[model samples]
Target chain A: AQSVTQLDSHVSVSEGTPVLLRCNYSSSYSPSLFWYVQHPNKGLQLLLKYTSAATLVKGINGFEAEFKKSETSFHLTKPSAHMSDAAEYFCVVRGNNQGGKLIFGQGTELSVKP
Target chain B: AAGVIQSPRHLIKEKRETATLKCYPIPRHDTVYWYQQGPGQDPQFLISFYEKMQSDKGSIPDRFSAQQFSDYHSELNMSSLELGDSALYFCASSFRGGPAPDTQYFGPGTRLTVL
Candidate 1:
């Protein structure tokens, strides 16, 4: 079975400071990893995805995540924080399990402080 | 780019009422997936379809059924609704356009409230 774990339920960061949201995965086969952001009362937006390409992937809004196979981790990060970056982030993994149905993490809520 | 579209952006119904949520996938996309998200909870995969047929299933309730149409649209039908059924339902679409056909594009979502 494929699964995802988001290390933080909530993260707070000061404006202009760096932000990090950690994620780890378990899959029997090579998996496709993704990071999605959902603003309050809004739909999910894909931030980035990893499909056996580069280990380090850059996404929208200056966000990026590194897929570490040795450690089975894919952590998302941003160089600086912005108020608009406040949202719920989900780590998703899609293995060969049944046509790649996504298995989502519990999610991490990001709060940006002024 | 044209994204997935869902109908009945917001719905309110009483228990035992039947509700139908519709989804129109992106043009040329051959796959559709449905997910349910409760308040403050992660999105859970309900089911998925490819080529207008059921391709995969997950965690979906027995009372809920879904199908993809020939036009590549899909519908989620929920019967005997319960308060716990109230949630945000999202439909995503993807095609074999690229190496990662699993890269799904989500719709705005339909907010369902059961009374």
Candidate 2:
């Protein structure tokens, strides 16, 4: 079974400061990882994805995640936090045997303070 | 670029009632996926369709059924609604022949409230 675990349930960061959201996965084989963000009462938006081509993946809104195989981690980071960055983030793993069903983490609520 | 579209952005229903949710994939998109998200919870995959055929399913209740139409649109039919079924339902679409075939674009989602 492929699953993702988000280390933090909530993370607070001041505007212009660095932000980090940690995630780890357990998979029997190589996995396709993804980061998705959802604003209040809004649809989820894809932030980034890792398909094994590159360890470092860049995404929309100045976000990026590095897939570290040894650590079984794919942590999202931003050089600077903006107020609009406040939202819920989910780490997802696509099941290899389930026709690409996404297994999601519990989610990390990001709070960007101005 | 056009994105996925879901109907009935908000819905209120009573227990034991049935409901239908519709989804329209983006132009040229042949794959559709559905998910359910409870309050303050991560979304869970419910089902998926590829080329108008059932492709995958996960955590979907027996009372819930879904199908993709010939036009490539999809519908989810949920029956015997319970309070636990009150949640946000999302529809996503992707083009299998596109460069980024695996990338899914999500819709705004339908918020269903069962009373």
Candidate 3:
């Protein structure tokens, strides 16, 4: 079984400040991890993915995440927070060598404070 | 491309009624998946279709059924709607079959309301 846990249900950050959303996972095998963003009334957009490649994966919109195997975590980070970055973020884990079902975290609602 | 396209952006139905949602996948894609997103919750997998065949069915109930067309389009049919069935139904498409790493593109989703 595979599961993901997002530590924060809501996060607030000031503009131009560094942003971090924490996520942890439990999987039996090596997993494929992904971060997806969903704007209000919009569909989910893939931000980044880690597929057993580089531990540090860069994604769209100047966002990135590091896959930390020892910690069992993959936390999303950004250097500067923009107003447009306000959205719900989901950390997903897909079981390796199994069916292609994705297990999603509870989701983090990011609020950009001006 | 156009990504995935779903029909009936909003639907309302009474109890014991049936609802059908349609989806057209992106061009050159061979896999389609259905997901349900409840309020304030993450999306849950409903079913998946690959090569016009049912690849996997999730924890959905027996009242829910799905079909795929030769053109890679798909339909999700729900019978005997209940209030719990009210949610956003999303259709997604991917390029190939079986564990492909390609990101699934999602449709706008249909908001179903059961009365």
Candidate with maximal DockQ: 1
- Sorted into a CAPRI-style docking class, model 1 comes out as high
Kindly report the root-mean-square deviation of model 2 from the true structure over all alpha carbons: 1.0
Which whole-number lDDT from 0 to 100 does residue A108 have in model 2? 97
TM-score of 3: 0.95
In each prediction, how many residue pairs overlap at the backbone (N, C-alpha, C within less than 3 A)? 0, 0, 0
In candidate 1 chain A, what residue range of length 10 has the lowest lDDT sum?
A94-103
Residue lDDT tens for model 2, A1-114: 899999999999999999999999999988989999999999999999999899999999999999999999999999999999999999999888636777899999999988
Off by over 4 Å in 2: none
lDDT of 2: 0.94
RMSD of each: 0.9, 1.0, 1.7
DockQ for candidate 3, C-alpha atoms: 0.59
| Candidate 1 residue lDDT tens string, A1-114 | 889999999999999999999999998878899999999999999999999889999999999999999999999999999999999999999857656678899999999999
Docking class of 3: medium
Model 1 residue B57 lDDT score: 93
Regions of candidate 3 where Cα sits further than 4 Å from its true position: A96-99, B97-102
Question: CA lDDT of A67 in candidate 1?
Answer: 94
Window of ten residues with lowest summed lDDT in model 2 chain A: A94-103
